[model samples]
Target chain A: MSKNSMKESYKIKDNYNTSIKIKSLVITLICLILTIICLLPIYLLVINATRNTSDILNGATLIPGNETLNNYKNLMALDGFNALTGFKNSFIISGSAALLSVFISALTAYALVVYDFKLRGPAFTFILAVLMIPTQVSAIGFVQFMIKIGFFNTYVPLIVPAMAAPSTVFFIRQFMKSSFPLDIVEAARIDGSSEFRTFLTIGIPLLKPAMSVQLIFAFIANWNNFFTPSLIITRTEKYTLPMMINTLSSDRYTDYGMVYMGIALSIVPLIVVYFILSKYIIEGVALGGVKE
Target chain B: MASNAQRRIKHVSYAKYGYFFIIPFFLVYFIFSFYPLVNTMRYSVEKNLSKEATIYDGEFVGLDNYKHILTSPDKNAEDYYVHAGMREGFLRALSNTFKIWVMNFFPQMILSMILAVWFTDAKLKIPAKGFFKVVMYMPNIITAASVAVLALKMFSNDSFSIVNNTLLNWGLIDEPIQFLADMKLKRTIIAGIQIWMWFGNTMILLMSGIAGINPSLFEAANIDGANSRQVFFRVTVPLLRPILLFTLVTSLIGGMQMFDIPYLFNPGTNRSPGTQTIAAFIYQIYMESRIKNTGHSGAASVVLFIITAALGSIVFYINRDKDEIAAKKQLKKLRKQAAKKAHGGLGL
Candidate 1:
């Protein structure tokens, strides 16, 4: 109970805290190293993109060389590997697909949530069944269908069928059931607003948060998708960024530097999109965890 | 009463609008998705010549293609995997698929467990945790094609290849490893890239699961004089069982259908040394065989579909809650006992 005894107790507590700190420091170091290992391949990629092909073939090192300008020059020099054209093609396909997909999915979701029609149960079950059928299983028939309708190498086949995005519809329907109150729709109807107008004006704005998450996901799905595109898209000019990046690797006489440069270019937009929309994308995937 | 009747009628009429809203989706689904799905079945039962190939030119063989893919005639090839004096394409693809998945999945699950524990532990006080998470998850978001290409180049036998050069320089090997050409090494590199691309996903998923656990549980453990390791094993992992099962099952489904990464490893080609996935084989048959062998491709798809469905249901069954399973078993036992008693009473 004396002052000297209290000071000695305080010193003991301080010693314990420092030991904890040392333990934490070691844990932190280990995590940092693992994180570095995860990112090191990508870092090597970006650094090598800046180096010439000759330098890259000589050896792989952490130190970045200065051939970025020449790499870009050679990359752009290749026919059909034009970054500008690739970006434009990708934006058009993915942007349109995401927008159309989410809009239809939300519309379908709204109908299912708000109305108690006869086919509502069956329709919901149908969507659930569709969710289990992997897209790859349908690839052959889909490509054949596209070719039958003479829609190959066109964006129509890519963008239009997004209306059938069962997962998106399912997610949005769940969101609506949780958040959307029927009274609001009734109130809007009483206010003389048409159903379509009400959905466009009120329902969409209210559903913006959920829609943005699904939209970003749809964009990424369509943007990075290569297998289907590779099947249907025959022309070089019609190629999306992923398809273009693949070509960079598989070309007969390949330039590793140029390929890396192209890969770097393809990923930058996604990383930018992630920084902007990562909060929602992460939350969306987590939301799916609870659903499962 | 009359006004109420009128409102009721209008409301009933308004209900029809549901049909209006859903029609576009159903229409597109039926035309683009459902139609093709059924058509794949149709294509599965046909035969044609490489049929320089026009659509609708093949004759229906009625399960011949299925038979061919499910049974191989070559009993002695001197090389390649054979079972029952034969090698089925479907079986080889099934085995290859599982081999690649197991190679990546077990290691990924363990590593992610450790990382999830590290980053989520407040006591660890890991610096720059956000930055690390973002970097680690970078590969998952990037196109699989790019990852494949980068991996192929990195693991190649070239003197400048990082994997080869590093190992060679460290005197770990006498010569460069033929990562691309060697059968085992090819699968290893593919599996390694898959692990690289996905471990972060599994980690993030596990981290979310950890965060979802009640904080009071950890406090109770602490009060009981539990150490961090004890808390992790006893308090944390048990609570994370559902999430872990979720991750495991979803990854199983995803890994089974893996195509782009393997295909991109060696594009425009029918064969890769050791990296042929089921989905990749389907793509190869559909692309290379033209119109004549459409049934063969369709058969492969059917096989893949069956595998995915069967495995998915099995995983779900395996991961069913223990309490629910026990309760169901008890109910079944009670029903049997009741039935037996009724039968004995009837005999009396």
Candidate 2:
């Protein structure tokens, strides 16, 4: 109620505001430094992709160079590093695998959610059990089985297993548990729709958001998958993008510029996709992180 | 109308349809996953190996392969590398895997925790938070194989590599360091790369975990005159336990399966003993080594499977809905009580 008391209160408030301001400024600077640390490697790769081999060998530089066309030409001329073929093979495998995984996982999740069958609980338990088993455990046997069955060097081994992605089904089922309305399925059935037809017509559309998120994730995972494909496909011409990049480790490929160009090409598409759909991908990860 | 529809839906037996819908998944899984798992176990016990470039499927040898890879020889044995059993190599690989995982996981946890707390703090006036997150997560989405190759190029043991060149230019060292040849430096770089690629992902997951905590709790802390440090240790950490447990279990399982980075970091015959993970060990015996030994690979895989199963069950148990379990227990108790009362009345 007095002028002196008011002045004291104002001084205290000013001190608090300045302290908060200092804290924010310090945190922001830390974040900026972290951002640079994350991007610097990829940035160097891109910049070196444009430089000549001698320049890259001499040292790392921040500026772009004039040898972009030369690097591309050298990469094309290199052996066991066909970028086009690698791209084609990777695209076919990843695209088909993603489509199969999302569709089948959605169907499986739908069954687990929409039905009240006797084996429903048991079926889910089986999936959970399967989820616990890592693929590396069975990898040696898988390769041998495929070899005996004459499926080695074929895309079947890579693509078919996508249909049984327990983790994807589990994630989608989690998404549906909170959002899917059972009444819609009943309404569709009463309107003379067959059960499968109802699922195809109504259930799938309702699950688009979850399906899309899983689709992107599945595609990226399949694309980046190296171990299984490396085990299956041993032929040089049939190599995936990762296999191609891995071959660059041999002592023969001493051309640093060309190697940088190859690595850059492999990662550029994912970066482009990330820049565009990052909001969904980041949110999807957050959604998947929290257990029901 | 709703009642009629409900009645019709109840009368219809969609059970078989559910069976039909899920059959494809189970079928694929059994053929691709379950059968192979069984086959791997069989191989572990069988004499399926290549000797002198000839493949042989000899009689079943129970536990021989496991002992061969797991049992150690005499303590005073000479020429350790020439020993019949590979227990030393296998153990070394397992330890290396653990070392690399621990080296990366602790630093990653600390950095991610700080970033997550800062980003999620409502009081902090952080700018461009979204941009920062996108950039940070960019490394995780890139092909790890490519990232490894990029790392090799950067830290190669020659003067021409990026890292060596930069250090030489900055006058930090008189000569280029042999990064991949030396065990310790190689492990450190591999661990550093692991930290770089994963900290962003861990940060995001932790941020979501922190966000799920009730804001009212923080406000209550503030009203009680608790500082940020006290609030973090008391309010936030306690509430974030479940998610933290989930992260730990998943990270452990993932660490057990770490293959691409360590395997690709030092390719060919020069792979240091310091960085050979379990997965790499399996791959080498079965695929890369001169003598292909499926039995040893299969036996090692069985060990990995057991570890993963144990870890996975912990997650499963923790994730089981507590409320549902309690509700089920209550229902069973009530049913028992009613049954007892009915029997007593009948006797009277």
Best by lDDT: 2
Best candidate, DockQ: 2
Per-residue accuracy of model 1 over B187-252 as CA lDDT, tens digit each? 877888888888877888888889899989989998998998899899999999877886787778
Give all TM-scores, in the order shown: 0.86, 0.95
Give me the runs in candidate 2 sitting further than 4 Å from their true place.
A289-292, B1-7, B51-56, B74-85, B267-269, B322-324, B345-348
For all candidates in order, the CA lDDT equals 0.77, 0.86
What is candidate 1's CA lDDT for residue A80? 67
In candidate 2 chain A, where is summed lDDT lowest over 10 consecutive residues? A283-292
Pairs of residues at least 3 apart in sequence or in different chains that clash in candidate 2: none
The Cα error of candidate 1 at residue B36, in Å, is: 1.1
Error of 2 at A117 (Å): 0.7
DockQ of all candidates, in order? Answer: 0.46, 0.64
